[model samples]
Target: MEYLSNWAKNIVYYILFVKLISHLIPSGNMSKYIKLFTGVILIIVVMEPILSLPNMEQKIKSNILNMENIIAHKDFQSQSKTYSKVNDQLAINLYKKQVEEHIRKLVRGEDVEVSSINIKINEEEGKNFGEVVSIDMKVRKKNSSNDLSIEKIKIGADSTAYNITAEDIIIVKNIKIALRGFYNISPDNMNISVSQ
Candidate 1:
């Protein structure tokens, strides 16, 4: 093969060069060092073909690609984990808002208006995840008048006094029942406050 011919030529040239150098130098300690150096070079030249085998380059390239892939895979996994956590938190917040709106709708027909609502949901990873944990709401009577008005008194025994506190308690009870029926929540987990 061409490779074999080239290698043989190289060895022949190296040997002739060494011979010429030895002739120029008298046999001494310097000649001994020169010969030792040329011997090492000759060994390398002889083993060049075996050292540069075709598969060696492919094996090295494959190992480099494997290392790169492992590093990239690790980076991707970490990024995905971070994205997943952010997405989960966003979902929980959105769900809580939706639940609060639903609660307001459920009590819309009642004589009370919802002032504020705070709903808590289970955040753990399980079957109960996203389930409503508790609800806190502030409501006020719908037709309540903020201004005080003076009116003519009808003190004859024919006028009946209306207990406003008793009516407010009834409205609160109705709201509790509606929420409990729809969400399967216990009374203990609900805090419904009526504001004047």
Candidate 2:
């Protein structure tokens, strides 16, 4: 009786193994082809949007009037009184957003067209503001069909908050003009110093 029971157990185990293996295998040619098609579709669906993101050919147009303050002045610590005079919360936010938008636009395009900008700060005021929160830069532009000369212009950028200070202004504007067909950005030329 024990031998008979053992034989029955072995048969049952073999039947289960066969059932499991059959279930794991693809049932028909149609099912296998369907899986291949689904995999291809999934790959295309996932890659399309990522590949279609805005390209670098997009132009980043920066309106000098809109970004005059933020782009003109450098961000740094400033005395309280001086900070109040130059710091425009609304302008700051607006320019900041515009900067980001402009970058996006440029990434989608090729070159950035800068018009003009100006900045001024009262060093005597905002004493409590500590170091300057921003510095001033002056920008100018001329209307023409040809590419602008960025090498002839100057640019100054300083981030006192991050301990980055730039005193020498370079002619990046000319280089930007040379790369007219490429993605380029030339803000302005400026440096931090005592107001005369």
Candidate 3:
């Protein structure tokens, strides 16, 4: 790999140098120099990756084929629609589990029983395309002993599936602090204080 990378670097340097000299020697210096330099830089930028891609692609293809063979040998197969449905459910479940764990840690209580947790997949009215799946959750937690309302928490977890498995198929992309309040809880929507 090192040898190949060195070889590619040297070839690119030589090509750019030759192009630079050829441009400097001809066509009145200034305009040609600018055009040739820009062109040479763009070519190097694009072609360097192209030149280095074959080795990486070969490794990826080999690994994928090996994985496929292993799965086939293990007699594992699912229809495309079924696989997608399973994946979506897995993603939602993963988000719920994470939220439960996080709330348990954050809230000061022993019997930290979480009430209903809802997850919604919002892909509309935004520019979140081909990136992370944004998940909105409405959660309720009780201070088990006193039974006091730990004001209904509204949070969001962002995730994307990568290496999906048979059982737990979703992978976490990122989870951020979205909103914290009791506004999501009441019939009349009374105000509540949110502390950091």
lDDT of each: 0.83, 0.40, 0.46
Candidate 1 lDDT by residue in tens digits, 114-175: 99888989999999998888998999867756564434333345567433455566777899
Q: Number of the top candidate by TM-score?
A: 1
lDDT of 2 by residue, 1-196 (tens): 7645655565566556546655776678666665666556556544544443443123122344446666455343345556765566555556545643443343222222333323232234355322223323322223337643333212354443332212112223333343233322223323222110
Error of 3 at 20 (Å): 7.3
* Candidate No. with top lDDT: 1
RMSD (CA, Å), each prediction:
10.3, 28.4, 26.8
Model 3 has a clash total of: 0
Residue-level lDDT for 23 in candidate 2? 70
Q: Which ten residues in a row have the lowest lDDT in candidate 2?
A: 162-171
In terms of TM-score, how similar is model 2 to the real structure? 0.18
Q: Write the per-residue lDDT of candidate 3 for residues 1-196, one digit (tens) a residue.
A: 8866776777777777767766666656476676677678767765775677898799899999999998876664456667877887777667556754554353323222333333333333356422223223332323234533333333344354233222111111111221123112222221111111
Residue 29 deviation, candidate 1, in Å?
15
Question: In model 1, which runs have C-alpha deviations exceeding 4 angstroms?
Answer: 1-65, 144-164
Question: Where does candidate 3 have its weakest 10-residue lDDT segment?
Answer: 167-176
